[model samples]
Target: MAGNSDPLTPRAKLAVTAGKAVAAASRAAGRGSGSVIGGRVALKLDPDLLARLAQNLDVVLVSATNGKTTTTRLIAEALRAAGPVVSNALGANMPAGITSALAGGSDAKYGVIEVDEKYLAGVARDTDPKCIALLNLSRDQLDRAAETRMLAENWREGLAGSKAVIVANADDPLVVWAASSSPNVIWVAAGQMWKDDAWSCPACGGVMQRPGDDWFCGECGFRRPTPTWALSGDHVLDPHGSAWPIHLQLPGRANKANAASSAAVAAVFGVPPQVALERMYQVQAVAGRYDVVQFQGRDLRLLLAKNPAGWLETFSLIDPPPTPVILSVNARGADGTDTSWLWDVDYTRLTGHPIFVIGDRKLDLAVRLEVANQHFQVCENLDQAVQMCPPGRIEVIANYTAFQDLRRRVGN
Candidate 1:
């Protein structure tokens, strides 16, 4: 993604200045990082502030139902091997926060935008990124966002004429279909662990024919594209069949999948896979995700998992059996105000653990766990939940707001 470095108009400059001032005030007041509010204020003053601020910066947007923040962070870090990068790493994938981030880092050479799935098209049009990483998309925030297929169709339609090189996930049928509209694409076999959303074809209402790893729509002739890059266990194979092992401080296969795709996107900016991954390996924690903190006499590893697809991936990263896990869920506006996705997650996998439930929608989670025949304890808050767990190495999985609450409580 790189836009012109032309100076902003008098009004745009004033709007940017006002937004930055408010953002600084917000930080000083401890009202949380002022990205969203400041951006809102700026856009209120000048609706085109995002496009104005995006000037002169090469942009690369990373969008997906899950891993938006982490992938943006990873892609930013990887791109750092080439030049300075400004990114919205706090899960603020919307226009406001992104505009604020671009305004904040106006001097940077590149921008890594973490766009919400629903807002991808507009953001792509505004930023006109040099490259975009289309990670896997699944049902998320169903109460607010469009259906999975609709969102994919939106991407296909929205990015129809963009010259941006799409680094798409080959393993995800929805992503493959969406990226197909783009003339330039670098396919990466970034694994899709949760496949329920891709059983039906988006190109046409038809069953996807799958034999082994290959997926094809029998009715519409839509199929999985051959990836130029593929993940083989912990290693990533490039277009030349050269294997580059990905080593990350971040835990789980999901992070490995992120790193693999990120390397490909970074390569679009002239950073080699080995160099990009080396920079990526330096990323210890994204925001507060995968961060281990000692709270209430226990070493808690905070894992953010908002939907069923996310929970499935998070479950694979958690400590097994008797390790004891804390699961928190919130139905706040940001959390989609829908807890039905809990039913889709296989909570039976957590059956052997001492599960502690917390947050505004703890009861919803408790009910789902009960239906899965997994016993759990309901706690009023994180403190009570942590107190119920045994000391040392506990894993905590929370939705958006709940995860942020944990970070705030831990003073991160």
Candidate 2:
């Protein structure tokens, strides 16, 4: 605290004190010190508290360009089938969010977290978890996070000497290249016939290309073996009874990769392929990530598009324009300061007419919608937008903050 000069520094201390109070209450209720409150108090003080907790437990970290929350939840659930577990199910990937989550669980032998790529190095250095799962690397939020290479470099430097078991997507040139030298590595490649957009090898940058069959480094010839487990057959089954015959719960091909990564983690935790598939199929979506809701007799789809990959996935989920959508974008600090990544998303795919649009940056979304030859009724608030929309097929797309407000409004 030597360099801490601001009086507002009380935030951390206040959070810690409140955490201790929760811990005492849990203890009074017959729970142990390992309960949520106690764990949170430790996290608040340790900043890297989760890693310290991992030193003595089975710590599994899930990070990715997309599907981190869903994969984290899926893996946590699968492991919970074995025993007690803890996770950041609220989709807070930052340090404070993580601290809040760990401080809330009790007697959990397993700690599963969905960490953001930008925070991976700090979290890894502090947590030293037993397992680290890197789902994939894609062009996302270039304004906030540097290109994917920066994140990969940080991962390489941060995990250089750790004894963590690295679980990676072999198909992703970045992930495979990062863990190539590690002895304790588990590579999970997507099945054949899966589309590949891997452009260059993040390590050598020698036009790392994926030939027709699988991924092969054009420069180093560093080829990755096929995934041990792949999503086979023409149909995918979901927990909410939605079936994707040669499709997925989320709209695009990228979610398929996310699902594969989740299954790989489940496999390592001793979940049988069939059982994992059954349990996986049972999961429809996590909050803010294409989570479908039935709002007043209408199909309300909630999609969180924080980054480019996420936006593309959202675009793929729907067919065309006239789908009746309500899109919101929050330019608030909590949602990140920059919104330039919006240019990377293919909004041209939107051919449907939207009923209502709202956000701090509603004009931004309106412009995007207008350029796509679609106009929407602009509203001042998310609640108003939800209320204004006709009680029929509706899709609510939002960024982080707007989605939070939307969730509260819709009671989801």
Candidate 3:
């Protein structure tokens, strides 16, 4: 079957039509992006609209605490080589967003979706995805997402009965624990540079030993699973140890890991490794995650780092010394009101570089930087901060809302 040619009942078809009308009305009124409202109405009407929409398409689901948006984009881009691929490019990962994407691309034969970590199980079950990518899990929105371990348990239970092949990051203990019970699994050593959240075994609650890069739990014998796909620097190695060079326009080791995982997922769908990497190289940015724009006579590169683990991975991508960096933080509902995760990040790595701080929570970041003995100046606005820095390409890193705000302010 091609596209959403799935046999939908008359009521389901009517529900989809009504949902599209509501979405069009929302866009006409300039209320919002209109993505959520339509999906909301559609689901209300049919109550099983997602499953109906997902029927008869090759679906790939990407979920994690971080990099889901980018990874989804990479997978979607790679899948485009085969045919038309539908995806939520707006970084929407909830049931509403997934419904919106599927509805919008009802004619597409392939679907690549980024799913919210909390809703992955339900979405996976509904979509019956052919492959599911489980990236690293860490502490995010404690007030909302609860602890990282609980989310892993949810994934563990949800994935145990899933027939879809699981492609997981073997380096992350949390991901390992969550995907261990999966019958069909493809482990990828996509690299995990941050381990603050995975110090203990999620299975037995015993302290995990990290001797070199491998991790193991002495009490339960839980350990990092051997990877079928591995990333060695910029090279991606297959099970036979043959390697393909991955060149990405998006910088960072985390992105390389994303590329590796994407390649693995693509391979499962019959896309060649070289072909996947070639498509990934063509991707410049993912919904403004990494985009360079001219603002106030300066070239500014935007990056989003919401949690401690995110910050750790993003910080590693920054050029050392001599380059000025802008750090923006916000404690909004979307960004997790608690700014305490800032202290968990190793701000000391940025000590020798010139840092300018700006955001609703800029003072909190300034205080943290001071405690870390990193020199930084507080700026009232992003443009002013960009001006304060020496003229050239400046890296601007922000949390969720702050990054969105700056992206709008910069006119991109």
Best by lDDT: 3
lDDT (C-alpha, whole model) for all candidates: 0.88, 0.66, 0.90
Global lDDT of model 2:
0.66
Tally clashes: model 3.
0
Stretch of 10 with least lDDT, candidate 2:
1-10
Better of 1 and 2 by TM-score: 1
Q: State in Å the error of residue 112, model 1.
A: 0.8
- Per-residue CA lDDT of model 1 for 1-412, tens digit only, reads 2545588888998999899899989999989889888999999999988987776888899999888788898888888887888888777778999988888786789899999888999998888789988998898887988899899999999999789999999989999989999999999988888999999988888999878888999998988888899888999899999999898999889888998899899888899999988888888988888999988667889999988899999999888789989998999998898778888999988878999999898888888888999989999998888888876689999998999989989987
- Residue 10 displacement in candidate 2 (angstroms): 23
Give the lDDT of residue 315 in candidate 1.
94
Tens-place lDDT per residue, model 2, 103-148, is 4544566778889888887777766677888877776644576677
Candidate 2 differs from the real structure by a C-alpha RMSD in angstroms, to one decimal, of 7.9
Candidate 1: where are CA atoms >4 Å away?
Answer: 1-5
Off by over 4 Å in 2: 1-52, 103-106, 191-198, 208-217, 220-225, 233-256, 281-284, 294-297, 319-321, 353-356, 375-377, 383-391
User: For each candidate, what TM-score against the reference?
Assistant: 0.97, 0.78, 0.97
Candidate 3 local lDDT, 1-412, one digit each (tens): 3443557789888888988899899999987678889889989999888988888689999999999999999999999999889999888789987898898886688889999999999998899888999998999876678699999999999999688999999999999999988999999999888898998889989999999989999999998888999999899998788899999999988999999999999998889999989988889988888898988888888999988889999989987777899999999899888878888988988977899999999999999999999999999998788878986789899999999899889988
How far off is residue 347 in model 3, in Å?
0.5
Order by lDDT, highest first: 3, 1, 2
